[model samples]
Target: SDLPLLCQHFINNYNQENGTTVKGISNETLQLLTTYHWPGNVRELNIAIERACIDARKGIITVDNLLRFTQNVSRQNISSENYRGFDIKEARKEAEKAVIIRALKASNNNRRKAAELMEISRSALYNKIIELEID
Candidate 1:
């Protein structure tokens, strides 16, 4: 769709501006960007793609390059969930669990790396992994 083409254009333009060799975006990367709900709209997408291109360094942009932006979008979606009768403590726990899961996934299930990403101690992450019953 237009999203992919837009991303491609942005990548091309960014390369030209930076004097870097133009690199292509993988279909997977385009799919990831297209599927995301851009809370900040085109401007945000433009910035994210620009950052992704810089991070990619003339290599194909991959989903990894878009992780931070996608994570922000996902967090916004989670925050919009209806908690109904849930107390503040319960909501906090839910949010914590979600963040822990994301950290784990982002770190490829490496507990140490996940803890570092969360800025928590390794033991704390292990404790949460047990407390949250995260699979």
Candidate 2:
């Protein structure tokens, strides 16, 4: 609703202002944002957005950037040292996959409801599950 409109606005201005043509993070970022149950609420989103914008030197926000925020939102600070013992990238992906599945289940598999529960858009959630290679 209001949130999609808001992100859309960000997408438009961000491209114009940065001249980098990177699509706004909404496609993937919104799914990450909306599916979290938003216990911490919009303040959390603001902080995440600020961070993404700060990191966007090229204008594009990759899935990697969103993944960083995802990890942050989950507070999974498994520490770089411990992750060295295992395939850290795979481990993180697995953990993130679990989080999305749990969120979907909590919302009864209704992607829209799940997105709302996560504070994201229905379409964004669908796109992300595919993008993340989540079954």
Q: Which model scores highest in TM-score?
A: 1
Measured against the true structure, the TM-scores of the candidates, in listed sequence, are: 0.53, 0.40
lDDT of 1 at 103: 82
| Residue 130 accuracy (lDDT) in model 1 | 91
> Largest lDDT belongs to which candidate?
1
Candidate 2: list runs displaced more than 4 Å.
8-23, 69-135
Candidate no. 2 TM-score? 0.40
Candidate 2 lDDT over 21-101, as tens digits, reads 555663554644554454556665555554466455466554445444454654332222113345545545565565567
Instruction: Give the Cα error of residue 85 in candidate 2, in Å.
Output: 25
> Which residue pairs in candidate 1 have backbone atoms (N, alpha carbon, C) closer than 3 angstroms, thus clashing?
none
Cα lDDT of model 1 by residue, 16-107, tens digit:
89997657777766754564678788888788788777767458776555553344643333221334333545644565677778788989
Once fitted onto the true fold, the runs of candidate 1 whose alpha carbons sit more than 4 angstroms away are 68-71, 74-135
